[model samples]
Target: MRVLFSVSSWPTHYSSMVPLGWALQAAGHELRVLCMPSQTAAVAGAGLPPVPVLGGVEVAVHNRLSYVREARAGQWPYPWTPLHPVTGAAMSTLDEFDLGDYLRTDGARFAAASAAGHDTAVEFAREWRPDLVVHDPVSTEGLLAALVAGVPAVLALWGPVGTHEPAPVRILPDDLGDSFPRHGFGPFGPDLIRHVLDPCPAAVAAPVRGQRLPVRYVPYNGPGVPPGRLPRTPGRPRVCVTWSTALSTMTGPHSYALPAIVAALTSLGVETVLTATREDAEALGPVPATVRLLERCPLYALLPDCDAVIHHGGAGSAMTAMVTGTPQLAITFASEQSRLAERIASSGAGRHLPGHIATVETIQAAVAALLQDVAYQRDAAALRRAALDRPSPVDLLPALEKLAAE
Candidate 1:
């Protein structure tokens, strides 16, 4: 079947969707991916074919106009009207951009690009007559077009659905319940659904409400090429520290807790790999040269050798640590993050660093406890076994394929 796969952007969003996309392609399905133009190269780097959408033009214009408006009025997103601009700072790193803000800030330009994405997809579907359309939730612009053109659409949600579900598309959870933190999935509660997904239930009733597909939470973050062996650093067990671009932006990985963590880990004789941006690392002050700092390594590559992981509860990062059978140290940055941290601690996979009191000492203590206690690792490994025992991509792909074919 010919399929038009749409998403918010590539590279950043690709890892979450590529495993499924590759499954469809390998099974002889013709698929074309659509995302923002800025992400073309990253998507291509993942070894997937790309179809660039012209949405970035509006994103660019909106950003500029927002600056102009912010300077003139000093109002944020101008909430009272639809002309609100969702500035970069106002958005969370994960699922940050909003169409309403884009529309309000860029006006006609945003409309034109959104229309173009719809038109392009519709035209492609009308010509190729794809059997189904699998869209990323953030690409509602494309989903709108698919609905107008009377095509079947399924939304692939990578993170928490954030309390809202767009219409005429299926909401498939990548991770849910207690497993959310263990697997780095969103902690989307029924309340979030009431707030975010319920507003337009009618638009999605037929496609989503009653029909929920089994979740597919597999992550393709395997160690990249060479998979070269690195010399093991023998020390008091090791713990891995990582941050998603969102956490890095939202709370600054260096927040006030850095010195405490670094000091604690050192005192425990545990080594650390602070995986984040160079700027974040610099902001963190003096680091023991022995502590490694990696800017762009994949999470999978880092998890295998670690005894435990320390992170700000992003679904992808959390899952990578869980799937590897390593203990986790979740530091909550926001409400969603705090929920995941609690879930992890409750699951016995790791401990939570209260966002309200995440001092250097609190962070240090959590890392020390995980590294020194073998029980956390034992429990973490058991949870990993449970996750592995559950349905995986190998099991989920066929089911999704059958759905598409039907």
Candidate 2:
């Protein structure tokens, strides 16, 4: 079978689909991952064949978030009337949603991702004629490509099924005005996806809606050599402190919070390993002499030896700790991230504080609680078992095949 995988340039997003993509490839299916050129090297590093698509998600998302900031300032990014951009996609005009703020933020995000590679992937799908196309929920271009090619398209959700559903937004590029009729399809939305794959463990995940299918959350931090043997200090409770690699790209209110968190952790006599890219590591200001600051390492490789974790609430980082059964403290920023932190706290596996409100005292308190609280440890361990008990990608292969066959 021919399968095309579409994802945004984000590494964490791409990592979510790696295990499933491998399952299909191992089953003898012809697979090619479609991503922007910025993500090409990382995709190749993951040992997956990457096909470059046209426009880049970087330009798209950057502009979209700028639009969000404008909207928050009470400035309208779009004119009273919509303008025909080069892609001929509508700007500022949006459909009715539960929140008007959502229309500008998530709406812009989806449209940007859709606009970036829509035409390129569609042309490729039309020519290559794949039997199936699987895509990240945030990157909806694959659906357009599948629609154009008249192939089955499935959604591979990156996080909680409920949290990751594609926002209902119309990204109808001007060039594709009459394309739907030609492709024999109507409007596409989250509800239109007949088969949706979810990897969140049931213990922490909300109830699945629609035709959602469950798969085990196999954690992958992408290609990197193991960080040799960990020389964990004797008799010290090790705490992994990270802003994640994604933080290097993040321009958030809490960007400087890491150094404070690190200082507090080390002052408490806990060994703190601060992980991030060199650039992000430098951004953390002065690191305490006691903290071991590593600018790079696969988080999964580091979590196994740790007793607790402190992180900005990137889904990949939080989920990695959860799967490894390590208790955590999440400094959640954006509203979307705040929900994940809340969910973890509700599950009894971790504690979370709002990023903007997290001071040295708060971070120290949260980290200390996770390290000292036995309930958090017990609960995280149980959740890890729940994830392990869920079906693996190999077990999910038959269902994916059945979906494609249908």
Candidate 3:
């Protein structure tokens, strides 16, 4: 079977798809991934064939202000943002981009490019006739195109879906939850937040509503592993701190309170490794002698070797730590981060830190507790055992093969 996977241009989005793409390919399915042109090399690097979509639109001007700030911060525009610099600029430059007056008004060329990408994807699928189409949470255009082509589509949500469980989901909505009102408004209207929550405005979930789609959760920007191997760690109480690399681009290294965290962890006699993009490492200022700065080490590699994990509470990081039987101290930045933190806390594997209010003192105490507290470690082990009981992607592949045959 030929499987077509679609995602926004962010590396975080593509990272999650890599394992699945590899699995499908291993299962003898031809896997092709569609992403923004700029991400071509990245997708290729992940060992998957790249299928360009979105008409190679360059939507940089719409986010000129953000781009300037990012440039000043030593970062460039990536498609992690909603009205992403790339997509917005594409909207401005294209004649066919249409998401209503708001999206199209940005520019004619941008509009054309957006529409062209979606239309082209649909036409491509009609001609190519892939057996299955998998879309990322934000790929509204791709989802629509798949629907138009009458192929079975599954949305793989890399982040929060916003709506609570039990809510009827017809199509994936693009709601960014309740944080929009907090940020200033201009081109990003309130609807932009709502739109992010459900990207597929027209998807009807009649046959699919209660039937859950396969949401294979993996880390956003995971440690690029060494082939078939995890990272090597020594015999000591290890502490790991990780955060979204994308956030490093928007805000500076999330350094409001992590320094205090390091101080506290050092006090606890724990060895720490803070992981982020190399750019963030410099922006993060100084690392304690005890704290290691890692560029790319598989998280699962380090988790099993750790006593505790700390971070901004991304779903992938939390789960990796949990599956590895490591307790967590989650310092969340966004609404979804907070939600995952809450889930971790409720699950008894970790605890959450208040947004923006996370202090070094609080983080220090949490890490201390996580390292010394037997209950936290016990809970982590319990959850890890539970996770191991459930079918991993590797275990489920055979079943999917049979389902595809049916």
> Would you list the C-alpha lDDT of every candidate in the order shown?
0.56, 0.69, 0.57
Clashing pairs in 2: none
Clash statistics: count for each candidate: 9, 0, 32
In model 1, residue pairs whose N, Cα or C atoms come closer than 3 Å (at least 3 residues apart or on different chains), thus clashing, are 163-192, 163-196, 163-197, 164-196, 164-197, 165-197, 183-319, 184-315, 184-319
Stretches of model 3 off by over 4 angstroms after superposition: 55-112, 159-210, 213-236, 251-257, 398-406
- Per-residue lDDT over 1-406 for candidate 2, one digit per residue giving the tens place of the 0 to 100 score: 8999988767786587898888888999899988878888988887789997745335334433543443455543223322222232334442321235654655555455445457778888888889888887655678778877777887776664352322211221222233333455665444555666777776567433447678887788776556766787788899988775644234333345776787688778888887777877776677666688775677888899999998877778888888899998888654345567777878888998876578788878888888887999999998788877878988988877786777
> Which of candidates 2 and 3 is the stronger one according to TM-score?
2
Ranking by lDDT: 2, 3, 1
Segments in model 1 whose C-alpha atoms lie over 4 Å from true places: 10-14, 54-112, 145-151, 159-210, 221-227, 233-235, 246-260, 354-356, 372-375
Which portions of model 2 show Cα errors greater than 4 Å? 56-116, 161-188, 206-208, 246-249
Q: Tell me, what's the RMSD of every candidate? A: 9.8, 6.7, 9.6
Q: Pick the candidate with the highest TM-score.
A: 2
lDDT of 1 by residue, 1-406 (tens): 7767776643433366777777777778787777777767766776667788535333323333333344344332222221224342433322244545655655555555555655566566667666666665445534444454455566554543332333211232222112322223235232212101111111111223334443445666533432344456765576778765544333333333545666767766677776775665676777885577777567787788888888877657766676687899877644445555666677677998865576666777887788778888887887677656645544665655565565
Task: State every prediction's TM-score relative to the real structure.
Answer: 0.70, 0.81, 0.72
